[model samples]
Target: MTYTVNCSILLTELPLLERPAAAKAAGFDAVEFWWPFTASVPADAELTRFEQAITDAGVQLTGLNFNAGDMPGGDRGLVSWMGRSSEFKDNIDVVAGIGGRLGCRSFNALYGNRQDGQTPEAQDELAVQNLAAAAEGVARIGGTVLLEPVSGAPRYPLLTAEDAVRVISRVKEQTGAANIKLLADFYHLSVNGDDVAAVIEKHAKDFGHIQIADNPGRGAPGTGELPLGEWIARSRQLGYEGHIGLEYKAPAETAFAWAIRQRIAQ
Candidate 1:
């Protein structure tokens, strides 16, 4: 499997439109991002410029997230939230359009945090429904819908590969769409105390994409204790031929350099 930079986390030094070029300059041929625009349905001009920027940079957009509310703040996702269902529906076609334009085949749909009055059962019911809808929409364009296990406060529901795969199974059963797949993010699994190697061995076939970040610090590969490069190599050995997204926090200009150097050393 090849590597792709997560532009949202890696190149904050440049404007959103310019990050793809920055990734290209760093020797990456592909990039991914969370929903870059605050609006679910951004103006066409904004979309055009984003497309142009990637086209000019000659970097492929390998993955993207649908609008997940405020990412920098505490909001993890919007798709499964009760009140935000309409907002997520509004984002579906728009996200599909962008992904279709860029030839991006995978999209991450974050399962939002648990609400106070909302029972886990209700949230789960809604998540399956929303994921089914998302799957149907993206399927029209031959794209796969991704569900990731995000690590954070205790309120977040999906914290392990098992958690995410359960949800993926529900959505697939609900829609009968084979396009629903798991996003096995090793950092979150490590943070949540799951055996990452066990997850890879068991769920490699379920994975549509994979992301990595070192544990303890969530920094570049060489800066932490996790055997990230080994896991990455292991993923490939396990038959996961998707992008290994560089979704860690590290200083710009040096992050990819360090990761590449560490891979070489390994």
Candidate 2:
């Protein structure tokens, strides 16, 4: 199986700019990240340095997230936030510029937590608009906008494949854009109680990208109860051809030990 290191989650031991080289040293040919900036539009120099790090490391930037606000502070995303639509829209160009430069064609747009002041109908409507705009922005580079079903954020509405696909279908139907797709994350799907095997069987061909982490603890494969290897194999059998993103939490020193074990097992 081809794997891409999710530098944002895996290489926290190093400074952000240094993670690309670390991933390269760790034997990964590609890397992915959440938005690696405090603001939607960072300064030019920050962008330059970020691009240079990936370039110098000789690794492909395969996936990136649109600016999801204050991730650690519990801001899941801005897409459905009642008053933050502009912030989400403004982020599209920055994302496109970085992805365009780094050869990243897949962008994850986290649907924000539901706001107390707004109706679900209102938020869903805004999300379709913003996602459609995002799809259009990245289409210049033949990019695909990815909608993921995330776990752990209680207010995050998309916690099942059906939920995310509903939104994806809405974006395509409303905007006539075919570049939007689902990011089937095995860990999140399992945590949310989705039928993982059924998801892969029915929707693997629809995935724009796939990410993995063992469930229960979100650790490296074999450290948790989830049968990630079996699920991944099934996904491949169903024709999902994207690199599997390693987006689990573990000490950087021992993160890839499971990969070694998997190789030996094979």
Candidate 3:
């Protein structure tokens, strides 16, 4: 299994476009993004700059994220995808085109919000529907969309491993795209009361990628009580080979960098 670090870990020092260089310097095989293209919305020039950074670093471009819609628009992103009446599918197209140009093969997206007055059953149906749209976009470019569950978005339908797999399976069955899959994020899973390795093993096939940080603190692995090393070993034992994304805040760059190297070596 290869370990990848999210440039968000050092967002301040690493320019948005230069994140790949920084990640490679720190010994990561690849890098993940959280809406970095969002640094310049719909701007082709800025996206091009990002493309060059990855090339300069010689690091594999692992994943890019779709827009986080629950922000200013209060669920406009997920709602757009959910309702199927809007242009949510079109939004994913932007990610596919941009990520493809950047040599990235994967993208992450969310179900979004728990808006007031929206019933759980209704939101679930919407989530399944939107997944089909995402699948369509991925199919066009031979790419993938990793659907993630978040504890923060309680109103959203996908908030657990089981929920994510069931919905993802339904979408795959319908679209036969083979690209739509689950994103097993440890921070979110810990927040939602699930064992990290256990859930990961059960859903390994559906796992598009993996993200890690210690529980409670969500800091770098060695900083907290999470037995990250043991779990990583278990993942390897289970025959799982994919990117392990470090999406935590490090206490200090120099110290965190050292610890990360040690963890990966283990």
Name the candidate that leads on TM-score.
2
Q: Candidate 1 — which residues are off by over 4 angstroms?
A: 260-266
Best by lDDT: 2
Clash list (residue pairs), candidate 3: 114-155
Q: Name model 3 segments beyond 4 Å from true.
A: 39-41, 70-87, 173-177, 258-266
TM-score of each: 0.96, 0.98, 0.84
Give per-residue CA lDDT, model 3, range 123-230, as digits (tens). Answer: 666766676777777767778888787665545556688877787777667666567778888788878887777885776655778788877777777777777777
Rate residue 250 of model 2 by lDDT.
95
TM for candidate 2 is 0.98
- The stretch of ten residues in a row with the least summed lDDT in candidate 1 is 257-266
Model with the higher TM-score, candidate 1 or 3: 1
How well does model 2 score by local distance difference test? 0.93
The local distance difference test score of model 3 is 0.69
For model 1 the TM-score comes to 0.96
Model 2 misses residue 101 by how many Å?
Answer: 0.8
